[model samples]
Target: MTTTAPPEHPPAGSAPGSAAGRLWRAGRAPAAVIGLLVAVSVLLSLGSEQFPSGHLEPGSPEPDGARALVRLLDEDSDLTVARTSEAAVRAVERSGEDTVLVVLLDHRLLPEELDTLAGLGSDTVLVRPSLRSLAAFAPGADMTGRVDDERTLEPGCALPAAASAGDAGVTGELYTAGNGVEALGCYPAADGSGLLQVAAPDGSTTTVLGTGDPLTNRELDSAGNAALALNLLSAEDVVWLRPDVPEEVGSATLWELVPAGVRWSLAPLALTLLLFALWRGRRMGALVPESLPALVRASETTEGRAGLYQSRKARDRAASALRNGFLERSVPKLGLRTDSGPDSVVAAAAARSGEDPQDLWRLLYPSQPDPYTADDEAMLRLADELDRLSGRLR
Candidate 1:
């Protein structure tokens, strides 16, 4: 195959409008398109403001975040946002009777931490508690129902906070008090209610608000949501615990995990690799290309590959190379499509060479174990046949 020769080396120039300048001219349009896209992206990004978003988070200004309620509570209460169960417990302990511990995402805490928090006996609010959290915070208070719709439910119970809040967007998980459990259920929906107030034996109250929707930034202003959140959380000190990604349970050193022998070898291995890189790498600038002869010599490449095949005694591979070259050149000349079926190729090849179709098929698309692969002479014979056939077609 022949190819138009490219320059053996890039012309040496440092000027702004030399060989490099032409390259720049060729590429500037695409670069300008990319630049415009980047500019538009930057402008769009600048025009839009993204608020930190998280579910019922105090600092997040997203629809699900409690930032609006948090700000309201911050006005009246000394609010502390804690990301860990340990920190939440500590925050509550530091405060007096005027403090209320409000725990969100209690599912992130361990069973022991939940029990310890429950044991604090502080006026607490559990938001969307898991069954385990429910059992720890308010025993015998089971999640009995769920409010699928986003309707505003009336405060049906006599809880001061619920009543003051009036009708609220408490459309979320619902719960029920056990038969003997002395608890007050509020905002009745379906079989259960959205809020369960259970007074601890130690004079502390555990208020389980079934849904977090009412406290989130998006719904805080709708129908007494702000009032209810403020009423429950307004205290001298309020500890708002919103758990983050759970901390690693246990610690293990990655280096220590490796075998002692392997670990000891790593230092020397790294040093040797660095030294080897420095020794073998290019010490200065880029490689200079060798100048090409004015005349092209394509046959040199073909002869070099032929010599390699002969040295390795790769008869099967040599036969394959011969057949592939003939097919590539003759198939197109024979008006056969590159993707034509094997039968069409075989028939066309047979017609062009004036040979029997079966013999042509055996030569071009050999059957089981390939008869030509037996020896060098057979491979030579196959190559001769393909070359003769291709010559005839030409």
Candidate 2:
């Protein structure tokens, strides 16, 4: 009678220890690494300063800050203090058509952003813009004069905005408009108008103010400044964009320009590569000690190696090999330990062979540029000396 037991199945392909288990084991280290990285990034972000600081910053309360005017504007209109061009554009879009976009410190914005903002077609106020910014918002208009004296300039134009504001301390850069264009100038100066309003093709009006002083906390209450500032900024929705100076703008960093996700993928990719390397390493089994298929004679092996050394013109190496081989064989025969120091071995060999210690030392332990290493003939001479020395030792 015969009874057979069922074969034992391996744990790899059965039940809960299959695919899910392997995946978990393989991915756990990488997952932990990703988790730590995310935690560190969050902590660093939390510790950083988010608000930008500069002139005309809506939140700042310094003398140059427009926080007071911003608060006043907020009381009458839904005000959005935007730090970037995209944010400003988005806020304006959300607020609908009745929004008034105020752009100050325009030099901080890129040239392209300025062009985009100019196309927004909203009733806008430009406060002390750069030459390029002026061109984008107000074509054919140029800064012509600068008023050095900080004095009140009467609203010389018949425009409603200036007429309502009355006389104001708007003493700063002036501008002039092109001929026949629908334009109005106020705050009279010697060379150009302090305030210039020009008509846009989209039926929106772009009013350029010569100075930012009227909107600052310091001069907000002086003269007709408050009235002028309010008149220019009046709307149901107000978008104030005072962009931050782009970091190291003249020589911006490469990291700042890289697309966001590319920088984040490096860690996971490295872990994946490492896991692949480990898996490959695991598949390699223990090394087997393989015996020579056919035993090689010592003399034949020596001659083959010597032939290679001669072909390569390795005279120094050949000389060294010949001396080391002779010492290894002869030292043990002279009752000296294999690890005996060179000088001790040399002295013992010199005594046994009755040879001069200096001459034996030169022949056995050669330095660089030894006579034997110069040519094949010299190397042969060294081999003859070693053979002679070996015969004496016996």
Candidate 3:
């Protein structure tokens, strides 16, 4: 007879020469894609100024008109112009000398602060450049003189002829003033004290110096308001109260502003991804068998076999496994017919061994019983008798 050859097994890890194997072997494309993404990110960050952490510097000093007035006061007056805040107001008030509180009121003051100024008595000279500021220091305190009735005026218009004559030798008659387009109207207090509202020298108050450009260094020299600047610095000891502009409280730094929660979440996700990558990169070792053994042992043989039986609904096959030993012992003792039906086999076994027919039936057929109601002792006794009888007969 001619010998037949065994079918060849596929080589371990070698491509099977199939469509799936060919697709899996094509790995260069994905590597190229990953390399392209990294290259793009690097190029963009290098070329673009708008990239994160791009070069940026704080803004250069802006031209502030108020700085001119501040410099003038610092130079001309016996006044020591020191920047102060709202917090220092009480301290300044407590000092209680004839204090010239030169407050740079950008907008109108609150009624309460204005009242506080009024309550300070005649010892205090409140020089406000704007009607709003005047309103703050002296609410309804004769704004008729502080603001001119006329709406317009000519340029280079001198102060009222009367004001020039009156303040000729007066010490603190013109306490503070501003030089700009929108000048607040100046007025004399009932006691002849000067409340020099920052207005144009002309009769018209409409050109009030709302823009403090004349006070700033850049425009102060250009605006030709040096005389007005000198008047504002007339006080012997002037206190410049520059309240800080209101800014958002508790603003975060660049690092603090970035959401840490998202970063932390991404970190964990990246760590998990790295672990998956390591798992994927690891080799599983050589796949081919070195030699054949008497029997091959599977790691989960019992569990896999049970699962297969369960999935196939093979109850009879499962019961056959349990009864295999019993059937071997009983065959000789009872001369049990191997090809007989379960009922006939069990009846013959009971008659030959003089055991309970029901017990023998349970051992052979094993009708599904309540898990809690199993007759374990009876089954054991039946097995023992069958074993003893099988030995004697043999």
Each model's Cα RMSD: 16.6, 10.6, 18.9
Question: What TM-score would each prediction reach against the true structure?
Answer: 0.54, 0.51, 0.34
Q: Best-fitting candidate, measured by TM-score? A: 1
Quantify all predictions' global Cα lDDT against the true fold.
0.83, 0.86, 0.46
The sequence of per-residue lDDT tens digits that candidate 3 reaches over residues 153-222 is 2222345422332322121222333334343333333332233343323321211232333345544454
Name the candidate, 1 or 2, with the larger TM-score value.
1
Predicted structure 3: lDDT: 0.46
How many times do residue backbones clash in model 3?
A: 16
Full-model lDDT, candidate 1? 0.83
Clashes of 1: 0
Looking at candidate 2, what is the lDDT of residue 364?
A: 85
Candidate with maximal lDDT: 2
User: Which residue segments of model 3 deviate by more than 4 Å?
Assistant: 1-61, 78-99, 106-109, 121-133, 136-209, 245-308, 311-394
